[model samples]
Target: MGWRRSGHFASLTEDEEKKERPKVASDWTLAKWIMKYLFKDFRSLAIITLVLVGLGSVLALASPKIMQVIIDDVFNTEFIKSIDERFNLLLIMTLILLSVAIITAVISIFRTVLLYKIGYNTVKKIRTDTFTHLQKLSLKFFDTQESGRLISKVTNDCDKINELMSGGIITSLIDFLTLIGISIMLLVMNWQLALWCFLFSIPPTLLISYFFKRRARKAYRKTRKTIANVTANLSESISGVKVSKSFTREKRNIQEFRTVNQENREANMKAVAVFATTFPLFNFIASAVVGFVYFYGGWTLIFGSTAILKAVTIGEAIAFTQYVSNFFRPILNLTMFYNTFQSTMAATERVYDLNHSTSDVVEKTDAYILPEIKGHVKFEDIVFGYKENELVLSKFNLEVSPGEAIAIVGPTGSGKTTIVNLLGRFYEILEGNILIDDHNIQDVTLNSLHSQMGIVLQDPYLFSGTIAENIVYNQKDVPFDDIQVAADSVNAHEFIERMSKGYDTEVGERGSKLSLGQRQLISFARALLPNPKILILDEATSSVDPYTELLIKKALDKLLSGRTSFIIAHRLSTVRNADRIIVIKDGAIIEEGTNEDLLAKKGEYYRLYQLQFKDQENGSNGH
Candidate 1:
């Protein structure tokens, strides 16, 4: 059987796509939202962090005061004293400074630890919540989103939030507080000199910061977008490597990847350039402040005549210079902090958008569990579409008796697979009802409904695990004997036992280590092990060789004996044994009956059967 490739629903224009993208809040708004949520549960940890920071800031501010005391009281004193007395005083001051430094270091260590705990734990919860939300979303969400973009949000975006919480938030707070404390101390010591420092330093610092903040935010935003593009490209390239090789498009793929990489590189360079220019400007302003202080204060001390300032001793001048350095230090650090804060805010906005997305398929509040369904299914006047004003299935109706087998055949885009999708509740119907055992599927819990249904798609997916684990997946505590029995029923046991590790053999990612036929058989065994009341085989044997196809047909006969099974097949021979054959066209059922009955009608199903099976029939006749 071959699949007819139908073009996807038309791609939306850029503007329309943007409109459909998740809405992101303003940076400040998102930051505040995250802060409130984080602190709601980590209030005590936050309080402890603040206390440690406050103590550390106080200790840091005391350094200049101690320096001033040493210079003014000991070095500049005129009182006569023994050398030993002088040494003892100096030693005592040095020991006090050492003690303060040690205590502050200890506090800083504890503060960092606490901040990390709060940051990591909060991010862990956020990541968990985001993943859980994604799980509840309908399959339609995945169809519209890129896997790489979604993966980036879960991993890269959360990491950025962690950076903000663990370091950016706490360090910025401490630096701001230290800036304020230093300003107050500087003014108390020498108001005139402090005035000189502020006049020269604050204006330039503010100007430089204002200029960089806007540029940095724009640059980092571009960087984030470029990185996401690169990630998306890489993911698609890896997943479609086989197709690329078959089409000899390796060079083209490389060129495409290189283009994305170049975009990312250019964006990073722009951000780096902004930082480069901003840092030097900050240093120049700081140096200019120091120069003004020395020139003005020295004139006052030496000449002892100035209208704007009082005369100062050498110790006071030295202390003032240290305070000047301390002031600009935080300013420079704050600039870097602002950059990190912007990046985090951007990431937060993305994460928040994903977590808040609404799922189209939602379980009703009063939905009840499906109690041991007996495989009777009904579709009444169904109307559905993947996009607005473009229905894939319209006014569709069907009824299946318990333990009956039905086969569905249609041209691609005739809404064949859509039936199974609707039955499985992967997408919600626009207008109509689907019932299992007379209970509306929408009114039943998804878990309870899904637990009783088994589906095997055209391309079987096997996660990274052992063969045995993949066979008994989700059916907990299934013994080896039961696994072997299921495999044997599907002709998978013979090959599995022939392998060195038997059932314990590892299947690499997506079962890359196994052939397509082997993977299908394993999937068949997996679905059968659960003994579901309803089984769906959508083109399940289409890709296998003739020998494997025969094996699958034999297995299907046994597996479908007592189940309400839906088989969607392109191969006419495969559906010949079905109790009923359904032919759909243009989202509507045109003909349906037993295989022989449909053939005798010489209608849509008859034409399709002839087109697919006529060549084989002719070959058989020649033989």
Candidate 2:
């Protein structure tokens, strides 16, 4: 049988397809955009950091020049006649060098601290904002995106961006400045030597960088994808470990995880290989330029014509060789920056893409706040589907009066739960409107609309916190008395009090420590504590034991009184006392009446009752 799936938890959906497709080449637009928006707030800190880096670079450039001065002039016989004067001059030069080193170190340390602060703050804001946006997004968004991939975006992607900001940007700037400063100094010292070095060095530098950039970008992109896949697979496997063990699929899961991990390792190896080869190639080129300078400079000093020999001093040649090394170092840094820039741009593109995605359901600017609902609800010609051209509910219409209790019963995928989902605005209908107390749900702010409603799912979720905290979640200043009263009303207080810590007991992750029935009872109490005008119990007791079902049923009587309640149940016996029972098929009401009236009619509801509850009743009688 073909069935339409309704929730994201069923499988990875369309968004995963979009993520897997090759990202369009960003051309650094995303990098620039990140700087423009995310880092704009840290402009002052960035400016200060840049200034400090610039100062440090200038000081570093002066070191080679000082070495030239000491070699050419400080020790020259003609320059320093007295031994005492020479000693004083040497001491002064040494002090100057030491002072430069000390000051540069101080500046470097301060700048690093500032950059770190800026990077962390920027990521914190981005992560917080991304999470906030994710929360505001429609259920359709979460339905399509993988949770692990989203976690990677908030965590791993943000870290890459931080690396770019904290290290890549400022270091690249300083390297470029230092390269230019050293290049100019070399040319000024001896133009002929400088010209030859540039001729030999620049072409090879450009060629090597050009080749590596393309490969590195591809490698990093692949790494990101594979790692994300591994993370998503791991998260799914861990969450479903119980199911895997129950089905004895442990070996299969392990093999699948191994495949994903191997892919990630391969991708990372490719990226590392590119970096490993590129750095040494750059160093070889730089060293080759230095070797050429020493050979030519030494040959000129020993055997060239007098003019040539005089033109290049020992000190000048030594300084020029140092300048050549300095120049190539920045070129190498810039090459590395190319790799960093590409990876960072890819991460930034993903983050911005998520930020720009508009939610399917959005609140209007002029949407009204629903004032204290009386729980009168109406569904007008609702047509809906979870996927394209596949209608789950077709032109469905229903009206519920204030204080009425409704039981919606149908086969799987018959759209029984879809009714309440639409009522909650979890998914927008393709056509028509849902209204509460005559206020169109779409015209009312979602916050105000949801505030007055409580939902208890078949599989209820409980966070890791004390029982009291979970019961009073999001309710401001809820008194202990109210919490106790709510738990007592739902028949949860007795079991809770029997626990070692009572309400203070920790529930553990997803309330795993508690039995399913206990969790459901707490969920019911949580829903009831809010004192909502409307309550929805979607198969709340379907998975519980018979004794637990009795407890739930006793609680439901008080909970449903004076409140508009919709109960979607698979077990037909549970809905027998509902004020009205609606039998739905293919998203439309097939029968609607009081339980006895529908049973007397012997229509769809009667058939369902007979097939589900009557058989069970006969078995009990036989026993």
Candidate 3:
């Protein structure tokens, strides 16, 4: 078997598939897309945040200048000979520092709040839009995708984008600005000292940053991919836990999970290793630059001549060293931003891919809404398959009249379910058209086509909620009396009412609290609640006990009344009561007629009937 990768549908074996990672859009492209969302609706909030950050950075630049003023002018014996005057100047500078600190603190609070708002709001929009787009996708898209990986895209990926918006982009921008501001201030204070510092600091800093940038990015991308794999593994395991236990495969499952978790840990450690080496190198460079600034500045102050290395003041050297530290601080922050940027790029690519995916079964642009159907349906020369160049239904044709009950029977893999799946427009037929009441299904809006039809699957799925809620799902303002009537019609009311809370009883996750037979009964009632014109029961009673099947059979007439129904069953007994039995083989109808007529023909239908009936009779005789 082969699988499709990402949003594109192409069949490739595990070994034939490329081992290299799929290429994504450049970081700049993805960053621009994220920025569009960040500012699209939250423009005002983003603008305010930027202004506050810029203002804070400017204030921070002023603090170092104030320290220089106090050291050089207020306390200098040569500049301030009078004690009273120096004291006044000192007090004034202290007050100015206090004022700047207070204003910066206030700005920090506002900036933090606004950044959070922008981050969460942007993620909320992306998450909401992604889910909405997912609903528009055809079943084919979901058929090829892992539910866990899709979930990771919506949740964990969006969260990564949030980390970038909340603190990464704007903070990095401000840090870069602060670095520039410190560089300029240092040069203005004493050019000679600033020139030497830049020579030793800037080149080494850029070199180290360049080295780590590539390594960290690749490492973080791997981390994101591995975590998504972990989530997918965990989700699949949880969903199949029952099957695992039944097969006594708990140990195997645990070992599999451990392998995935270890992969995640290794990927994270690789990223950590890159980060761990980066900071120390930057610190070493910063310390070396500061040390040289102190040495060179002291040399000029103590021994140097008049013209070339102009002598500097104690206050100036102190400010220059402080500015060197300030310069490296922003470099460190920018490094952190690059780390976040890499992860965001990885996540954004996935989320964008999912949101932009093309569905295989899209309605035409001018498609019309299908009016209430009378259940007349026709499949004209249908040809289809789940994968390329593989036809499950080839040149198949069928017509169903209003109020007719159809039982389509065939051996496994004979395309029985594909017929009904095509009828429901879950997958598009490659070669022909399916019409409902003479309106081509492809020409009708999917919502309109699906609205009048109800389907019950082999494994009936009930969402976690009260029984009443699941019974009346998506049917607003349904009365209790109507629910009770629907359940009663399916013989589900007796069991429901027997429970302590009756209709209000919780079904638990996927209706795990209920027995298989009970779940099928509930599914029957749910399908009939809307009084759909067309109903499909696909292996619906296969898992039920004899007594439960009898209950369903007793209600079958009422449920099948006045509706076009397609019953796809391996159990020949279920089809015996259908209006007509269709015996299919290899995507073609071998025989189809009333049960007795088909049985009289002694054809494929008869063979299937004898096999099932004899097995049942022998089982009873053995008991």
lDDT of 1 at 81: 64
The residue ranges of model 3 lying beyond 4 angstroms of the native Cα positions read 1-21, 80-88, 210-280, 305-308, 620-623
Better of 1 and 3 by lDDT: 1
Question: Could you give me the TM-score of model 2 versus the true structure?
Answer: 0.89
Q: How would you encode candidate 3's per-residue C-alpha lDDT over 3-78 as one tens digit per residue? A: 1233121222222223332545554666677888877888888888899999998998888788888898886788
* Candidate 1: pairs in clash: none
lDDT of 2 by residue, 1-623 (tens): 01103322213322442454356535355656667644487888777887898888888888777777777777666764578866776788889989998998899889889878888888887778788898889888889998767887888888988888777877888898998888788788887777778889988887887677667767877997898788779888898989999999999999999999999999999999998998889889988988988887787777873543335776777888788877777887787786686567667767877777778789989998999988999999999998879999888999999999999998888998888888989888899989899899999999998889999999978999999999998899999999999999989999999999999999999998899989988998999998999999998888877777899888888999989999999887788899999999988999999999998999998887777666676775111
Cα RMSD for candidates in order: 7.7, 7.2, 5.7
Ranking of all candidate structures by their lDDT, best first: 1, 3, 2
TM-score of 1: 0.89
Better of 2 and 3 by TM-score: 3
Ranking by TM-score: 3, 1, 2
Mind giving the per-residue lDDT tens digits that candidate 1 earns over 387-456? 9999998899999999999999988889989999999999999999999999999999999988899899
Go through the candidates in order and give each one's C-alpha lDDT. 0.85, 0.83, 0.85
